[model samples]
Target: MAIKEGLRPGGRSARVQDAIHSAVRALLQEQERSTVTVPQIAARAGVTPSTIYRRWGDLAALLADVALARMRPDSEPAETGSLRSDIRAWAEQYLDEMSSEPGRNMMRDVQASATPGYCVAIIGAQLQTILDRHPHEAAPSVDRLINLVVAPVVFRILFSAAALEVDELHRLIDIALRLD
Candidate 1:
């Protein structure tokens, strides 16, 4: 159980974080979420279980971090000039990510974990970035925007039988923007 180099309390090495995150994603690809364990992740990551525990606290926290990292927009939100178009683009990308199996799994873990606010905070930051670009119209608060745009998509993802339709998402954006 050789711990990776650069182990420090409260100061994680980027290399170690990358390795752990990569290991989690790879294992999740082949294993059930419930079956994945700290030792398994440590083995895959080439670090000791203690390293993971020191860094992430527990399996759920590690999974939540992995999922949140995956969920983050790879690029900046598309700036379509109008607030409505921007919101639509952001919401669409968000919904697409959340609709995936891994995304759903991650969301479940995040929802169940003690650090649920991390997910919401990430989303709020992304939306805030978009809102910051165009301050012409008064932008809604992040909480309001989440309720208007994200809540419904999450509701459908959790409870609805069918996948959320593109048109339905567009309608949601419309409703959020008060365009209809």
Candidate 2:
């Protein structure tokens, strides 16, 4: 049977991908980063190592794609009328994600890929796409505002530490989104 995205019908691809994701997610949670191995993932997924290699090309690519897919920004930012509201919405979406299992896995993978240009490229592309859709002009101030809005969440994720409370997150959103 044919599979679409993450959906599976009856056949191989869906089963394989699901197993792969499960294995990867579990490995990420249970093992140290340096200890994760292709054989371990394959065993956890109940597939052969060759199966993973065939499906995802390599571990880094597989991790990157999964991480980016999970981290894909939500629609919350779009309908929010005010800039502050929009930014808050964006930050909140991420906050919600950060509290989840998949979110934690994605965050860890992303941080690990810090030295990889492809990882930075992926983030830059996503950020640019989001900013491109905004009606307001892209000025230095606007750029700074976006950075300010983004910084708190990223800082928390990267540092493995919390930077802002709910109130502070809201305040940061308020300050960053102000058009003046």
Candidate 3:
């Protein structure tokens, strides 16, 4: 959804957004995604169908918006003493999540949106946070981390019909850190 400039996020707008998101999440859990419709979401969200159409243009966009929200990192990367250890931990977790069935589904849904790199930016920020923790050690740029680790992991999960093993993820991390 395109954000409206100057709109306060804590009023009727925020409440409606939250309600709509919650309604979508609940409906997805209860029914097949193909069965979900604008009217259904509107009724469940306590809003008019026009509201959703106006804000999201259609159901696909709304679902994509919801998927983006879910893909965002909910916590900081794990804190380990060394940069390599921290990156390894983060990469392993990333591989596990993005390789899961639901995770792959979320990635597919999020790809439907106009701003696909939004999720990448979120991941890059998280990687940078881990890199920032170890100032004394040389670290790869966040973009490098994503290119060397995230990109390959995502490719394997979505295209290869298999997840990267921990050993493979470690090798990717080593390659990423080797640039330093």
TM-score of each: 0.83, 0.59, 0.94
- The candidate scoring highest on TM-score is 3
Per-residue lDDT tens digits of candidate 2, residues 1-180? Answer: 112456456577767777787788788788775688889999988889987777666677567556765555553244455444555565677666674656666766666544355434544554454555565843225456546755666666567555457777787766765557
Top-scoring candidate (lDDT): 3
Q: Of models 1 and 3, which has the larger TM-score?
A: 3
Candidate 2 has a TM-score of: 0.59
Residue clash pairs of candidate 1: none
Worst 10 residues of 1 by lDDT: 1-10
lDDT of 3 at 125: 88
Off by over 4 Å in 1: 1-12
User: Runs in model 3 with CA error above 4 Å?
Assistant: none
Q: Is candidate 2 or candidate 3 better by TM-score?
A: 3
lDDT of 2: 0.62
Residue range 1-180, candidate 3, lDDT tens digits: 744667798888888888999999999889988899989999999999999999888888898888888877788999988999999998888888878866887787777767756887888889889988999898888888888899999889888967888998899999999964
